[model samples]
Target: MFSDSTITENETRRDLPAHLEQLLRTICFRIRVQGREALKNYSITAAQFDLLQRVYFNGPQTMTKLSQSLGIAKSTTSGLVTRLVRDGFLDRRRDETDRRVFTVAITPLGEQVIKSVIEMRVRYVEEVIKQIPEEKITLVHNALDILYEVMSPKQH
Candidate 1:
C-alpha cells in the first residue's frame, strides 16, 4: 500500500515527461522565430541559412554530403546550392581530381550573414539572462549545463 506522499511523488514523475516536452518545444519555437527574424535582413530563408551554417561549421562538402548532413534529398540540396551560388553566398567548384563532383563553400558574404545572425541571437539570450535574479543565475547556469550534458548526443 502506497502512502499519500509516495502517491504524490509517483504522480509528479508521471507528469514530468509531458512537462519537459512542452518546455522544450516552446523554447525551440521561440529560438527559431528569433533566428527567422535575423535571417530576413539577409534575404535568406531559414533552410538556406541552415545549409550555409552546415558548410560554415563543417567546411566545404560535396552535394551528396551536404544533402546527407541536411537530411534532405540530393535534388533539393542541388537547388539550394544553385540559388546560393547565384546570390554569391556560396561558391561551387568541381573537384580537381574527381572532375564530376562539386563542392560547395560559404563565401565571405555568407560568413558575414552567419556572424550577424549569431550576434543577434546572443543579444537576445543576454536580454533573457539579464532578467534572472543575480542569486539564481548560478542555479540556472548549472541546470542548463546538466540539461545540455544529458541531451547531447553521445560519442562512440
Candidate 2:
C-alpha cells in the first residue's frame, strides 16, 4: 500500500499535463489578443494580416495554395486577395505559361505592415519578460527551447 505522501505525489504528476495545457493556452490567447491590438494600428484585420504574413514569409503563391494554407474556402481567399490587391498591399499576376493561373505576392507596403506588427508584438513580449528576474529568465528560456525542440516536426 502507498503512503499518503506518495499518493499525493502521484496525483500531482497526473495533474501536471492539465496544468501545462492551461498555461500554454493562456499564453497563446494573451499573445494573440496583443497581436490583434497591434493590427488595429495598421487598419488591417487579423485574417488579412495572417494572409499577408504567410505570403511575405513563403514568397508568391497561387490562389489554391493560399486557400489551402489559410484553411479557407477558395471564394473567401479570392475576396481577401482582391481587397488586399486593391489596397496595394498585394500584387496578383497572371501566369505567362498558364493564363488561367494567378499568383499572389506581398507588396513592399505589405512587408512594412508585417514588420511593424512583429515589432509591436516583440515589444509587448519584451515588456512582459522584463518583470521576470534575470536568473529565472534563463531557466524560462531554456525550458521554452526544450519544449519547442520536442514539439517541432522531425525532418525526414
What is each predicted model's overall lDDT from 0 to 1? 0.88, 0.88
Residues 1-156, candidate 1, lDDT per residue (tens digit)? 877566676798998999989998997777667756778787788789999999999998899999998999999999988999999899999887799989899999999988888887777778888998999999989998999999899999
TM-score of each: 0.86, 0.87
Stretches off by above 4 angstroms in model 2 are: 1-7
* Model 2 per-residue lDDT at 99: 88
Best by TM-score: 2
Worst 10 residues of 1 by lDDT: 1-10
Please give, for residues 37-75, the per-residue lDDT of candidate 2 as tens digits. 766766677788889999999999899999999999999
Clashing pairs in 2: none
Candidate 2 has an lDDT of 0.88
- Regions more than 4 Å wrong, model 1: 1-7, 153-156
